[model samples]
Target chain A: MTPASSMNAALERQPPRLMLADPILTMTGIEKSFGDVRALRGVDVTVYPGEVLGIVGESGSGKSTLLRMMNLEDMPDRGEYHLALPGQEDLNLFTLDRFSRRMLRARHIGIVYQNPHLGLRMNNTSSGNVAERLLMAGERSFAVLRARAKESLDASEFPISRMDARPSELSGGMQQRVQLAKAIALEPALLLLDEPTTGLDVSVQALVLDTLKRLQRERRITMVIVSHDLGVIRTMADRVMVMRNGDVVEQGLADQIFQDPQHEYTQQLVHAKL
Target chain B: MKLDQLTKPWEAFSYGFLDQSAKREMRRRILKAIAIPGYQVPYASREVPIARGWGTGGLQVTLTLLKPSSVVKVIDQGADDSVNASSIRKFLRRVSSARETLDTMEADVIQSRHRIPEEKLREDQILVLQVPNPEPLRPVQPDMSEARIMHGDADYGQLWLTLYEQLVRSGRIMQGSSYPSMVNGRHVMTPSPIPRWDVPKMHMAANLTILSAGREKRIHAVPPYTRVEPLVFDDVPYRIEDHADKTCYRSGVTGFFMNELPQDDGSSSFEVSDSQYGVKHIRRQEGEPVTLGETYYREGRLER
Candidate 1:
């Protein structure tokens, strides 16, 4: 057999996306660099439909860089990104114009940032934050907006009494709840979380993590989460990808990676976690 | 008055009159604007006899369609004898032999500033509306090219966001004039500085409406039987000015748009905005027969 053909066969069997006929997102040969420094080098991200994929790495390891590219927020210098959503099958997101890309992101993809200030507008009421995306997607009915905002906030376990309260007026956990409520308000096909609970204290982080897990399960949403917290990756992710120095070192089922890590860096990470 | 984005600055004026070629050029642009409703068509705006921004856009249209047999009525802020309306009417008569009248039904062409005629216009009439700003995206996107691209792509999320922010801050939409409306379900056009009450009159109306901006050098049209819907949320319905309960003192007419005249002792009085309409009301009261076209509003609510 030709060497390149053999390698292609081997690579095809690697990600679980190939096992399933159609994946929600399939990215190949993604590369991004800043001047002389490479943030991501030849990264391939494959996310199956309705599966949770976790990316774990140390600081400056390009875990967040890879996650950002999934949402088209930070476009890779070169890559082919094909995504499938309901009614829109296999759209090449990388080649879309800015206007269409923005519309697609608004109507299809939902993103949650680590900082509540970045994710939720601090001045707007909690319900306003949740309703902003719906409004942008052309939902004009105030009664429907109110009901849907209440439904999302209630689903996220946010207090119904504080629906009109602003994000700055709430605690960190409650603010994260609002962020979660807004991200899922549209019921987007894909959700990307970047260090969702990193800024909170340990107790608040646990509360926020619990809320995130419940929402993810109930919605059955396909997700790609980037976190340095191994416990989060262990409890939440179905599969895990390990990265170091702008390259993915190891990836497999979450249980296998935690119990018997294949790479030395992954073994160090698994062993270092208490 | 804002010169920061003048793409084609005014180079010269030709005695404030349009030649036959200029009129033909305007006809082409008007036809294009009508063909693609609500899309702004750029044109060479000639400096008319009046000062800039003083209904020169509407005056250009009036001059273009001027004929000795044409009967023209000019109204500003719903008043026939207002300074702006009177000057434009005298100018039209002086330039051409066209007759001037304050009666809405007698006029073949009506050139207006701000408000449409209170009397429902007929299919035979054409309404020339003077526009100060043609770009509805000006508030959200300041760059002309960027605004053009937004219009081309029909990306109006920022406009909705602005309205949402305003609603969150205030109790209602504070946009009182030039209500941005969706024309032909495709392009969002500013219905020229008209009040919210007058916007619904253009939707599926029999009369043709042409909006033009001189200083901005842009023109758009809403041909007969087109949809002109104000941008509003379904649950948060569009509310017009609250003038239903008020009555006009001069003509004893109630349930029409009124202007609140303040008194010296912290009081107010109501006057009918449509001055000629009020005159007709007084003439009828005096037993002089005057035909009043069916008003667009009855009991201060638009029938359509």
Candidate 2:
């Protein structure tokens, strides 16, 4: 093997650093309502760095809303969202203004939508889309943005040659890679994904999941992924939060959540997936 | 003319000329521009209470598109403090009480003429260029109908020929301001009055570039990463304008194109002038006594 390839192989084999000292994201008594439609009701969840936390729930269970609330995309009507920094207390994300929240999202948080199209700016090229969050964070130089974009695209296993190609020209899997490239580019502290592989084919799904796992490992990023697929959740999540009708029905280690689900909803979900 | 008869009718008719209907129509056009990305739409143009050649399009657009929180910056020729620049800046302050900025980096909405700012614009920032005309084919084909047809068919043969002729005459592309371009490689558009130096800056620019011609009643867009090529032949390629003497009196900015103001004595020697028509007098009065505090404060702030 070439020297570079051997080094890369060795790096991949090395165990990632365990930096799970404190919670990066903490949601307490989070309540959200859309004009009589209670999307979330007193949902409490915490996420730690170097950890993958899966949120599993059936349709209309408010799992998606819970994830959105964590990212500050959807503000809970009543709750304390304390986003933990390295040496700082959990910040109350809900109290901050819209602009500040958006800035925080751009700087510290990255979100991947269930539909990759929704996550990506379809009109821009792959590199442009990847560079967008960084641009929004006030990284203005074209050269710096381009270089970072190329690096991120390569890290995500996206074709660097197709960096100039727009989302419309790419396949679904390729577009998803662009979305992944965008999310991972910022090296965000918290990565919130809403059913990232819902619409993808099984073969494509496996590839995307593998890439995501590898990225999470490399970056030591804290993740909150909402998915109904128990198998995917088991594969990717270190811990699991099972929600039903906006409330977290159960929370435990991934192995425990699957092997011995305490909640009836979690059990039914597992059975249904099986 | 009897005073009683004139006074009685004047009161009723005086308020009638203050028709906000035209402003409403411009607002509708601005909305349509947002809804239909990259589609140039025409509206009933109004002569904004500002100068004709001076940022009237940008002023009208700003007036129509302003939200309460919008931070605005107006640059004429490229610098922020030119005479025409201050006039529009003052007008926006009077009309909307929107926050005004001199820093190109800080502005949420920049209304510019002749140049894009040297600073790179952010995605949230929207650039409104004051356009003399929106049709890129205007120089090549004067007929509006023919221009539209050419744009509809993507026939840019005449545009290519014009560049080819420039090459034959000057050995390089001579076209400067109002550089012709293809928006999204679909619709022919203009980059307004910015120099050829700033023309290449528009290619795949991060910010949304919007052009408005208040007199022409048209609005067009160049979405981010859109191909914005200046017409050039292979043998004689497109060249950016060079500024050997790059200097900004106030900002200490160098290597940017500066306007030359002819002295009143009719001397051939040209003094550095701001991009806008009127602000040279202020700069002259301020003189080389660089008030370091003012410069520092202005630099600290962002332009809108």
Candidate 3:
């Protein structure tokens, strides 16, 4: 059988359904340090499938570091990263070899960094950027990759006809959407977004967020977004994790974290936003 | 004091003063290489105060390409710790202070001579070859201008004819050392000074093959999946040489072209008698080991 046909069959066999029976990602007693400075200290969090978990914190509060740890891009000095795979329960991402973890990230996990310009190659066309992950996953045929890339762009509300245009020609929001298209093209089980809408204007941010919400619903993708914007967290997050000095001060449903914040730090954050 | 004699030490120290400028130039060349993806560029190469056949080219490339996270490997012949290999390794350690490895499988950047490692290389890994001469046409025509003009017009007829003539004379092409092949069917490139035994292994190889001539100041690449054909004649056929057996005493690896070692007793003990015993013995003493096993023999002839 052809490779494309086999990939299609595999996609069909595992339909886009949320599996919430077990926690998709679990971080236990996580701690990180750079030289003498401690970034994260004794932090624990759990992420379930098909849920948008927002991690809100101030600058230098270790939100980005935590996200990096989750993606296995940076290993914590002391932590356990137990990630759930299909038919497997809580595999430690940190313990795996670099190649194996790379394979897992390539096939099952996708990350969108904060800088849209950095996320996608500026020299490559939009379609090229979108199709990169698919190509890396052993999809060699240009026709099939282009088709899937086009479909993803259209789904993400991007201008599909302009797929040949480079990222430098596109606006910040459009670049973010192109990155989203790239991440979603692989049909990743987990999506880790780090301030994906920070550079875009409000209108563009709303459009991008709406696209993400629609994608999460259709693909049943689990999302963990790290951002400082409380408004964004309120709009998309099912649960909120409020961090302070590398500690999760409050974590519960978004409403509870916003309306009935128990910790002083969370209260101060809400007051500052107000 | 005689002016020339007095100025000699200053001339020697001038290389140290010129190092920063040379590195900047190399960085620009490397950036151009990355920007164009597979294109090679000429850079101002310095005599690294090491042996010519050593990894001066690889060292220069690594110095230009290194980041804090890079893990480097250096191999000579094939094993990691031959005398020349250790010499380059020590130089890099002293110069770049970068991490070094003997394991081919783990290196992010590898500097190799004579043989590509038996292990598969990852896409992220970069392989740099030390090249004596970058031009494939230098052997046929001694003049640089004529060779350059021939390369410009993609004229490889002379090379093909030479191979055909060798085949007619010997029933097989018997040339070795710095074998010539076409890169992407566009540029005729020498696969450095590796033995002819390792020539066929570079065909459509997985890693990006970068060749640098430190003395010549030229760089080139054979991109992944690009055709690398050794010029051959149809009647006699292009045949590759291999050891009768794959055995390396030091590395204990199989399926590798090996160097044969002489026993300490000096009794002419046969380590599987085959063609080119002297060359193999010299290579073995130089720390290249034969791959363990019986030599792969076909009808009484051992294919190199």
Candidate 4:
């Protein structure tokens, strides 16, 4: 059976009512508009827990917009969005107010922007930036904050000795790692990544990609990564969604999308990458 | 308009020149600052009659702690009667009805700019130091938010590098005042532009030191019994000013810090920087009934 068929068969095996149950996120008819332009047009996405879902598209394709929506940084003009947290009922993210959304973002969502400068505070020490997230999570103990900061840095392979140095003093790859450390410090259930290694050197990108893949596997984190780079998706994501002009053109298992493309836009993407 | 609704009561001015709410906020921040020994606590620094940069931070702390029974001493560069010091002292007294004293030993709370008193402060005393720049990392990292993060991380690599460069460029470290010193083995604080000699006095001292920068909007504390070590390389030891042996010309006091009066002939006359200390010494010489407290330094050497 084809990978797409297999995915459908797996879904069919589960109870019909429980199909959307315990997913990391569920979005239906998500529509966003900027001025007269449609940023996202009727986008629907469902992410399973512990799965890495890659959304691939060029600029203005609404990939970043979709990721931002997941992060709760931006609200769609119209849509139903539900975030299923572990040991809790599905959170109606769209219905919550701003402060509640902020609390949810701090507690359960971690977003890594394309630009390190946008994602991380350049002057804060690596560990400090991480501790900030912990502070937002209502951690008051300095000793505990320091310990957790150090632990997360160590886990991300960030040099413990350099924890005190600001982001401006670090290399680009190291800065990204610091951002990762900060994002993961609170142990968020959902990780939203926006072109995480877009500006790094090829070798550095490889290393960062490897670290990210390893981290996702080890932590069993549910991730929605948006990138224009096909290689990034092929390496890190288990499933792939192709977007063009604010709409998903096609989506399937990573291997299926690479080996056999059902849609013309996806075929062009695969062809362009090769 | 009803008189009772118009105002609570016809008062000359608020106590301590700050309303109750302002004092309460300051007290809350002060407690947090003391709890996290060297950490810079951000507070809603209220506006007073004084300008933002001129000892407003120290004034706020003093006002928050002031009572009718409190004895306050205000000093500028060790002189108790300088324009800045006397003005602050007058303001403190006028607003709070607190007694003002020139003698360091008699004062319950001492508000100072750029210098610690020559005399050792008792445990009951609280030293409010007016800081122009509170960030020790400003020279290395210019951004305040970034500097704060650096403080959180305990990442001070660039600070050491700057010192190393200073030693290489000039045979000695060129840092003059506001010597960067580590507090409680965790935070590096700018000890309020006080000379190197005064910096050491904060190290495991009996009195609580509150360094507040009104312009920068940050307050940090060096609590009693906390370690405050001036940053230095292993090979190059931290040195106090060479004025150790320079005697005060007017009072004949040889061990204390001195202010130089430049003469036309290129020779500079040195006077005791702590004006009150010198006054006490001169009074005692004239056979007046005056008692001097134990000083931090004795005979040009800092006593441990």
Candidate 5:
């Protein structure tokens, strides 16, 4: 069987979300515009715990913009973005003061970008890239930092020998692995990936995706992944949301959405993949 | 030039070389600087006989604090006899009529250019450091107003990124002097031009340290018993100079910051950077009635 067929088989065998808590994220009526162009128009999303929610769309579909909003990288023009984690204070992402927003982002959220350069500090060593967030979170002891960085790098299946190697010196796939290592270093509660494997070679993409899948399973982190690749969304995400022209066209379980897509855009996307 | 002509004129200048109003303004600004810990308070930097960039910042503060009975010691790059240090010392004494001493332990106020005195400063003492550049963010940011905003926002990511880049490029941090440190958990400060060896001495130190830049017209303080942490990565530890293992050739002081002197054979001999401290050690070894205060570093290691 081809890798695509194998991915479908794995998708069929995947388990359902393990728990049903209060939605970790509650965003409604989210709207964003740049000058005359509306990047998002009344987007609403509710994410439960321990579920991989994949956002798939064509270019300029506001997929990346929505992921950015989810991670608080950008503020929607009009929306109520609340984070209601277990036993934690409900954080209004838009209304928080700068310091509190920073603390919330640092402690709970992790983001991996489409390009590794945007995520990893190119000049910093692989371990330093992983430990940078830890340092910013007020971690001081070298021993503790090295041990924790080692654990994350090991989980990402990165070679321990390259711990001191800078990201600029690494290959594209290795750079992406370093980005993954850095993002998951603190074992964050929420992981947001924006076209994380889009820029890598096909073979390299497989390795990175495999590493990401293993990480998501081992950590059971709530994830919001944005990609145009249906195979990626199919093999990984439990639930899928398809977007077109700054709106979520359809959202449902991964199997139902792919097997019997309702929206024209989503059907065209699925058929194009075949 | 007749002696009688020169003797005809008698001038009355303000005490401590600064006018009453200037001193009062400085006093108010100093208090604010101390209260805010690492926040730089701008002041009207006045002119003095010394040049603007050369220990003038330290001189202004020393002049403001001096009284008839206040004992003062001054050092430049750890030397008590340097031209800048001695001139500032003499100028301070001449104007305020304060007592002058080279010994660090005997001073009420210690004005220094580049190094912290080797001896531990007491609670009664105040250290006035001459800061050439008060802004630690200046390396990453050149715009003063924007730098101020970053300071207000407690945004030090660029400064930390510089260190991170240095670690990767050089295999070690290349900041030889003027180490960037976080003061009291809020402000990232450049602790004057003191070596990395002396940066740790300011952490929760007993004495109050005021860093003033005359050219820049900014003064910031590290109040007594405040945290002064050097900006460092956790995995890449902060390392001091390798001078700990070398002994001073002149004073036989083994565990202090040192100056290297090139010899005829191309070998370098070490001497204690704190000139007066070394003299006291030599005097004590020669059976003179001398008292040596406890040093910040002992046996080539910093005492916690």
Candidate 6:
């Protein structure tokens, strides 16, 4: 075997660390472009198990693109993407075929879109929308479907009575809760949230954020969140990555990043937020 | 390059409005559904000109099986002449040029929404029942993936408990339509929105029944002679709607499903819910020779 591969093989044989030895996700030198426009360039991010990693950037800063790549909805032009699933070795995501990638996304990764319409089926009941994901994962019994959906919705602090209401009938905050319920129904190992509280009112945003924080704590799953709002990142994320013009400028612990920003752009963002 | 090679001969539309590939896919799924009786088989339900939830499932099945010589019957709540039924019938005719019949006995394929025919369906006939919600366990198990596992394990304890609770509270099985029934002692299927009376017709029946839900993207089947037993305690015998004794005021047909028409007075008059059967009765009374097929219910009671 080659030197690097032999080292990797040796690393695989070693017993996994009991805690924080390996990250759940590792993306190295990820490069992506849309025609002539470069969306992401040499981006690298690693998130430990159960850690909430936040990506904060202005619009068109490649935050959404990188988030989508984690779920394999968007492919990087070049990168080494490795995801270590629970009870499994780190999988080289891009090397695996398309079907395997989809199965992985369906079973291991849960994504909450910025727009609830993109994630929630508007015509189906809120519970039904959550049930759709469970059904896709091969659930068929109505009894278990209802019970599990009720539990997830209850976890999000959504009213039990409104579980039967369609997403169109719900308030914006309630719809986001429904989307969260849908994503987490599979009990995915990785949760991705994109601007989950962007469009809601201040009070509603708090309610949604609180519910989300509770669920994350209760589930204890790895999370990667993308947002333009630094306050959201500070509230929920353990680590924050600041990006600009399709490149990450700085990344550190959430507190460290806020207290002492090194990059000029990050410093400007911090000052503006304060 | 010849003209024939450049383009095919002019035609109004494909045989079933659905292209050949779509029809082929439907045929494959239908065969699989029939083989695994009462098993909900998934399919890529294609978009039709009609809306998604409006009998599109039954329409797709009918279109797949339809031929120029096949006689088609479409019914909405037992009425062949209702706007929805006739409109579907017209659409089928426009696409496939199949013969349209109001008589259930003469139809090779019958697509129905929410009800089954009063006249007994024959062995050769195929019943395509439109299902709004195919998952019978939806009320009990809202998560479909878990529901599927329950089906695989044949775990229906919760469903039975639900019935028991209903019986304890209401003193009767209060489920009005889409009564859940066990097919072939295996899967419990929602027999579309068919009334309780029409459900027993599926048990040890001579016709093949296909239940499809377009929006839900599922198709399940019950073949001839398959056992379809409704969920019930052995002590409390299964009961249908209490319309066995009511007579149709218009057709003078007694001992069949009836639609109660309320009058300006405090009372209500009843008419046969099966519109075509009533029409046939009216015509036969006027000296038109029409043979009414044998029915599942004889003299207000279902005959085994």
Better of 2 and 5 by DockQ: 5
lDDT of 4 by residue, A145-213 (tens): 668989988888889989878889999989989888988888888988889999999999998898888
Question: Which residue pairs in candidate 4 have backbone atoms (N, alpha carbon, C) closer than 3 angstroms, thus clashing?
Answer: A123-B146, A164-B155, B178-B193
| CAPRI accuracy category, model 3 | incorrect
lDDT of predicted model 1: 0.84
CAPRI-style grade of the A/B interface in model 2:
incorrect
How far off is residue B127 in model 3, in Å?
20
TM-scores of all models?
0.82, 0.54, 0.51, 0.56, 0.81, 0.59
Encode model 6's per-residue lDDT on B49-69: one tens digit a residue. Answer: 889999999999999999999
Error of 1 at A80 (Å): 3.1
> Per model, how much of the real contact set is kept?
0.57, 0.00, 0.00, 0.00, 0.39, 0.00
lDDT pick, better of 4 and 6:
6
For residues B133-178, write the lDDT of model 4, one tens digit per residue.
Answer: 8888988789887887778767675666555445434658789999
TM-score of 6: 0.59
Q: Scored by CA lDDT, what does every candidate get?
A: 0.84, 0.71, 0.71, 0.84, 0.85, 0.85
A best-first ranking of the candidates according to their TM-score comes to 1, 5, 6, 4, 2, 3
lDDT of 3 by residue, A29-144 (tens): 78888988888887887787788889999999899999988877888888788877877556678888766676678788888888976678776678777766776675644457
- Model 6 Cα lDDT, one tens digit per residue, A88-172: 7676798877667776887889999989989976866787777667655666455676788898888878899888787999999
- Which 10-residue window of candidate 4 chain B scores lowest in summed lDDT? B160-169
1 or 6: which has the higher TM-score?
A: 1
- Per-residue lDDT of model 1, residues A79-189, tens digit only: 788887767757668888888887888888888888888888787788888888888788887778789999999988999999888899999889888888888899988
DockQ of each: 0.50, 0.01, 0.01, 0.03, 0.22, 0.02
Where is model 4 more than 4 Å wrong at Cα? A1-21, A87-90, A94-103, A121-174, A201-203, B1-73, B86-101, B104-304
Query: By how many angstroms RMSD does model 5 differ from the true structure?
Result: 7.2
Considering summed lDDT, which 10 consecutive residues are worst modelled in model 6 chain A? A7-16
Tens-place lDDT digits, model 5, residues B1-304? 8998779677799999999999999999999999999999999999989788998888999999999999999999999999888888889899999999999999999999899998899999999999999999997789999999889888787677677657656768999999999999999999999999999999999999999999999999999999999988766778899987888899898878999999999999999999999999999999999988888888878888
Q: Model 3 chain A — which ten-residue stretch has the worst lDDT? A: A1-10
Tell me how far the alpha carbon of residue B193 in candidate 2 is from the true structure, in angstroms, after superposition. Answer: 3.3
